[model samples]
Target: MRRYVFGRLGQVILTLLIYVTLVYFLLQAMPGDITMMYLSNPKIPQAAREELKKQLGLDQSLFMQYVSYMKNFFRGELGVSFSQYPKPVWDILMEKLPRTFVLFLTANVFSFYVGFVMGKVIAWRRGKVIDYAATVVGITFWTAFYPLLALVVIWIFAYNLKWLPLNQFIDPRLWSAAPFTANQVFGNMVYGAAIIGIGIFFIFYYLLRGLKPSRRSRAQAWALACALIAAVLFVAARKGMLIYIWDITRHMILPVFTLTLINFAGTMLLMRDSMLETVQEDYVMAARAKGLPDKVVRDRYAARTALLPTVTSLVLSLASSMSGGMVTETMFSWPGLGQTLFAAALSNDYPLATGALAFTGIFLLIAHFIADILYAVLDPRITYTGQSGV
Candidate 1:
């Protein structure tokens, strides 16, 4: 296991190195100088532009610039953004990353848990009315009109109805003022706590319900505990003991639903097919012949084998997710890395663009590495053995 992990980690490092090198050169090859973009304003003199170029090391040969950039990258310097004034590319990413993390992590977790449970139920009840209905609902909800649905909900609830706030992270009023009083801080915490607790319960109920019998009981208990906490917080929030959870949900909900819906059909289909295939396998037939309960056979013999392909699919999906859904983020104005990358590309911000590319590559490499490890874990017959194609 150690050997397999180390080997995959090595490959991940190599992949990232190669990708970063390629992106640096590709960005360098693009027309129009970083300095030229700034100097085009005509306020800066020729000598000042030359000095800036020299300072930025853009005056050097392409090879030298690449070498320097690599050296700096190794030292954890991602270089400065040409488009943004007096800010490093890394700094901009860092500032935006927490928001993206909060949004994407929440959305991914919600989708995976909910989708997995729905898939499991459909798999177990294959060919039944319930299964068919779920299939139709899942496909329709996730694939066809999920984004439109979210839009309509937002329009009705937020814009027309005035029940929720529209677009923006947190309430501006809460953030605009200087140091908050203890009461304000406590109020904010109460509201935030309630919102998160309630959101998690709604999103993860299916996941808890789908766990193995031995695990599901414990998960239910935990869910109950969370419900109690959420209830308490909700009461506090109502009494002004807590501030209203800032209505970031408007900006957050669409992207979350879009991602979930985009991935739902494929996940469900994959699960259905995998389960069917597993049920038909000789081992499953043998288990059934041994007079094992249908549930036991399904869970122990079938689901285990079915998960291998699902893990592989999940790994591949990570690349698309981490690339940052440009169209989705742009349409919703989510202010995620996807939008940032798109903006950089349009403005020809080489440093920011290259940084974004590098980040995407790193995410891909990590996702692939994780998938490789999971593959080994899911199937004992498959061995890494320090060689390719386990």
Candidate 2:
């Protein structure tokens, strides 16, 4: 295990170096620097442009600039944003990353749950009307143009029905009168989520560790878990954080809903195909022959094996939460890492854009490492030696 981990960690470092180099050089290769925006302005003299270029190190050899950037980046410096001048790229990323994480993470979780459940049922009832209907719906949404779908959903829910917020992360009317910044509220939300997650982890760990519980016992266990979550939420309400959270949730509904619609289809299809193959396995037949209930045979036997691929996909997607959704963020006027990267690239803010991409690349590489380790744990058939996994 140690040898395998070390090998993977080494590969991650090398890959990250390549990724950062490519991002920096590619951004430098763009048509013009940030100074291009001032070129047509007659009042900004040529000397001023030269001075600005020198200040930003745009005058240096590309190789030297890359070396300098890599050095600074290794030392935890991501440089300053050229568009939003004097603000560190790290600060901008920190400010926006949580919002992106929350949005995509929520969407991915909802999509995974809904897709997995639907896929399991449809696979079991493959020849039924319900299966065909689900397949048609999933495929239709999965193939639909994402931007158009998002716009239509917004028009129906936000603009016409008046069920949700039109756009932006929060209601300006509500936040403008608040004492604290939105970031503070976001930080509190993170803390509350962490606490609740840890609590749930313990609850499941203890309650489901040994043998199966009776139906009443199982219901009580779930109730206890729900109460634990509600307690955390209650504390947030007492601390006056709930109102802002609700506002953000209201704004989030349309995008999250739209994303879940578009994404769940792929997961569902993947799970369905995997389950179809898994159901014919010898172990599944054995389980059925032992007089086990169909539900238990399907879930405990077929579904668990079929879940491997879905779980891997979900983990990688979760890692990509840092990258954010460019169209989703932009259409909704949600200021996040995605929108930040989009604006930076358009404005030729090389530092900010490269930083954003590099940050995302790092997360993706780490997620790959985590997924590889998870494969061994999830399947006894797979083994990792000092060499490649088998």
Candidate 3:
């Protein structure tokens, strides 16, 4: 196991290096230099532009520049943004990243839960009305054009019904009187949400792990989890923090809803297919022969085994989501890593753009490493034998 982990870690490092190098060179290969953005203004003198280029180390040979960038990157210095001059690229990303994380993380988690649950039920109840209804709805949403769907959702929920915020991460008017920045509020929200998630997970784990398959015990567990959530919210309200969190959440509803609709269908379909295949396995038939309850047989014997592929897809999706959803962020007027990357690329902010892409690549590599480890844990038959596939 140790050997496998170390091997994967080494591969991650090598892959990250290749990804970063590619991002740097590709950005450099763009049509115009960063200085060209400034030179478009006639008042910016030629000598000043030359001085700026030299200051930015653009005057150096491509190889030298690449070497310097790699050195600085290893040392955790991402340099300054050309567009937002003098502000470090890391700072901009930091400010934007929390928003992206909060939004996509919430969306992905909720979508996965919904997909897994719905898929499990549909798969177990194949050919039933519920299965047909869910499959049709999921497919419909899945096949819809995402941007147009988002617009329609917004138009219905935000514009016509006035049920949610129209766009942007927060309502500026509401936040104007707040003492903290939106980033700070988002950070607090993330921490609060983490606590809530951990608390709920423990409730489900400790309360249901050894319990027999029954509606009563499951109901108790869910009740406790819901109570925990409410308690967290109550505490936040007592501490005068709920208002800020609520504001952000209200703004988040439309995008989260739209994203869930778009993504959950794929997960559901994948889970359903996997579950169908697993149900035909010998162990599942043995479980049925033992006269186990339908739910137990399906969940324990079939669903867990079927979950492997879905888990893999989920991990990759989560990692890719860290890159940010460009269209989603733009459509919602949300400032996130995706929007930042888009703007940086358009403006030729090499440091910011390259850093964003490299950051995403690193996460993807890490996710693959994690997925490999998870495979062994989820299935004992998946053993590490020092092979590349392992």
Candidate 4:
């Protein structure tokens, strides 16, 4: 288990390293001299311009700059932003990241559980009217363009009815009353803990039941570790944040609804198809023949095996969440990584752009690592050697 985890962690590090190098060098190779762009003053002497270039380290060779940048990066320095002069690139990203994280995190919550349950039901009742209707809706949204759907949602909720805020992530007015308090931060942590706790409990329940001592003990360890962490946070959280949480939820309604609607279709369809296929396997029929309870036959015999593809979809959704909803964020004027990346491009802010892109690559690779961990946790019969435990 230790070796498997270390191996995956190494792969994640390598992937991020390659991504940073590629994004940096590719930006350098792009047309137009950024130094010239920055020195737009026609009256400035060539020597003065050269000095400015030297100051920004644009005069250095790419290799040296890369080495220097990496050394600072390893020490938690993201360098100063070109546009937001004197402010660190890391600081800029951190300001915008939370809003984007909340947007994607909320969307994932709706898409994942709703898709899983709906898919399961539709597959179980295939050929019924509800099934066909769901299939049609799923495929339609799956194929629909995100911007178009987002516009439709905006028109309905923001324009026609005027139900939701048309732009930005928060109602700034709410801050007048409460300000940015530790309460909101702690409230978020508490909510996160509860969610994690429920998920870990199910992992233990599904995989540990009737298992051998070693296998069951591993599941118990995971359960206790997760529970302890969550319990600590839950105990510490302040309920006062719930007041500000209301405002966050209000702003979240439109974009979250739009992105979640767009993402829901594909996950549901894929999960349904996977389940449908798995349920038709010979073992499902054999399990039914052995007089197992219907729920037992469905869950133990069918659902577990059917979950692999859905798990992949889940991980991909999680990775994309880190990228933030580019179109959605833009349309809503949300300050997310998507909007920030666009700003970086326009300003020719390579450090910020590269750092954001690198974070995204790391997010994707970590999501894959998590999926791997989940696979082993959900199915004790799965092994690090890429074989069934049997």
Encode model 3's per-residue lDDT on 30-147: one tens digit a residue: 9998888776699999999989989999999999999999999989999999999999999998999888888988888888888988988899998899999999999999889988
User: Which residue pairs does candidate 2 place in steric collision?
Assistant: none
Please, what are the lDDT tens digits per residue for candidate 1 over residues 327-380? 556556667677888888777787788888887787677778867765765576
Candidate 3, residue 187: how far the Cα is off, in Å: 1.2
List TM-scores for all candidates, in order: 0.75, 0.92, 0.89, 0.84
- C-alpha lDDT of candidate 2 relative to the true structure: 0.86
- Candidate 2 — worst ten consecutive residues by lDDT sum? 205-214
Ranking by lDDT: 3, 2, 4, 1
CA RMSD, predictions in order: 6.1, 2.4, 2.9, 4.7
Candidate 3 or 1, higher lDDT: 3
lDDT of 4 by residue, 82-183 (tens): 777778898777777766766776788788877887888788788999899988887788779878888888898899999888887666777766656533
Best by lDDT: 3
RMSD (Cα, Å) of model 1: 6.1
Alpha-carbon lDDT, every model? 0.70, 0.86, 0.86, 0.76
Relative to the unseen true structure, what is the Cα RMSD of model 4? 4.7
Q: Identify the leading candidate in terms of TM-score.
A: 2
Query: Could you tell me how far off, in angstroms, the CA of residue 383 lies in candidate 3 after the best superposition?
Result: 5.1
Q: Which ten contiguous residues of candidate 1 have the minimum total lDDT?
A: 178-187
lDDT of 2 by residue, 1-390 (tens): 788889889999999999999889888889988999999999999999999999999899988988899999989899999999999999999999888767877788888888898999899888899999999999999899988998999899998999999999999999989977898888888788778777876666554344353567668768888998899899988988899998988888888898889888878888899899999999999999999889988887889789889888787666644554888898888888889999999999999999999877876887788788767766667788876654
Candidate 2 vs candidate 4: the lDDT winner is 2
